[model samples]
Target: MRRVLALLLLLALPALAADRPPRSGLDYATPGVRAMQADDFANPGMLWVQEGLALWDRPGGMGGTSCASCHGRIEGFAGIAYPRRDPRDPDKLMNLETRIEKCRLDNMGAPPYGYESRELVALTAAVRHQARGRPVAVVEDADAIAAGEKEFRQRRGALDLACAQCHEANAGKKLRDETISEGQTNGFPAYRLRWQGVGSLHRRFQVCNQAVAAEPYPLGSQEYIALEWYLAKRGAGLLVETPAVRQ
Candidate 1:
């Protein structure tokens, strides 16, 4: 069965963790991409940010309340290292996308903006943009961090490669035409040339899972929240680059 084959492939891969501290994907980006990210006008991700800002003011939900009604100006919001334990429900982990959805459902009386939807990505990016240079800092949850670290190391998909293999062990090395980076999460919702649009960290996870022929968990799934929590911890000191451009 495919499961047996995948396990066998996983067993065959090497187990080496990069000893260096975490590095942002920005370091590996091409000059053009870096330039694009640097310039507000040039960054296509800003388009989503614009949309999100407008949406923040527009009335929504059954009550016809806008996000501004409660949260005020989006620019004043501080950056967060999310996928943390939700304050309202300590048992649950909520990322920015989930937080936005929760507000829409519970506060605004609006329908949830499904994961990877343009509106969700825009709002997430807009909020994150406010915290552009802040470092990733969140209260640690040992259980979730450990679970995520395990997920990061485990090999999946038909290729049987673990995330550590490329992002940790072989970072900065060439993988065909492109260089491999240390797979940091400080940047999202980011603009990828391949995607040709802004997308969330979970969207990136799905793409990575699909790349190796593994089944991807649902966006905002607990598994991903845990993985994202681990990644935020791993990239603790890195500054947020919400609209980062990546190859």
Candidate 2:
């Protein structure tokens, strides 16, 4: 009975293709989620941004210097060219989260935050928030982008689903109560009602992979970073939506 009800609910959802015409995951969101994101006061994700700013000013590391001391305000720093080819090691890719970890250990002489750690999420949110309204640029690394594109196209795991299956071909189609999307990353570090918390893009990526019965990669892995880079490129011209709310 429960399974039948669930199936009915999925089918009952309206066929909605591309929720908002102008673009944005916001267009696809439920009314409650859209309203939550519209109001800064009500958006629970703001708490994490607030926490991120706090951590920015707090002193850490063996030498005791805050992130603010080095970079000042974090605004205008996120431009969506992340998962860049690492300067020290061209083979390695660095996303906002991984870059933060690197800075903590190398520049600040501080311990790196654990993956998906509160501190890491806060910092990443704060950084992305700075980039709000900025356009995502094309990646310079040809090889990496090519590799990511290949991954995006290939079917994987038990479901044999590719990232493009829904995001590219079936985007805007109804999936149960929600609509499939072009899979933009502009609104990352977003507040998800399901999570009841702010989560990184990689976190959401993991969820998608699991949903498809694919073996998900570890957070911050090269695979994820590559995928993020490609996704960012695909989402070029979209505004960053850090701390945005999602259903």
Q: lDDT tens string, model 1, 40-158?
A: 99999999999989989989877678999988888777655577778877888888899889989988999988988999999999999888999877667899899898999899999
In TM-score terms, candidate 1 sits at 0.90
Expressed as tens digits, the lDDT of each residue in 1-247 for candidate 2 is: 9999988876554233223332578877778888888888998998999999899888997768989889876764765567787899999988989998999899999999877988889888988887877776566777787778787877988989998778876777998878987788889989889998989988998999998999899999998888888877767678887888987
Error of 1 at 174 (Å): 1.1
Candidate 1: where are CA atoms >4 Å away? 1-19
Q: Model 2 misses residue 12 by how many Å?
A: 32
The predictions' CA RMSDs to the true structure, in order, are 5.7, 7.8
10 residues in a row with least lDDT, candidate 2: 13-22
Task: Estimate TM-scores for all models.
Answer: 0.90, 0.88
Each model's lDDT comes to 0.87, 0.83
Residue pairs in candidate 2 whose N, alpha carbon or C atoms collide under 3 angstroms: 186-241
Error of 2 at 61 (Å): 0.9
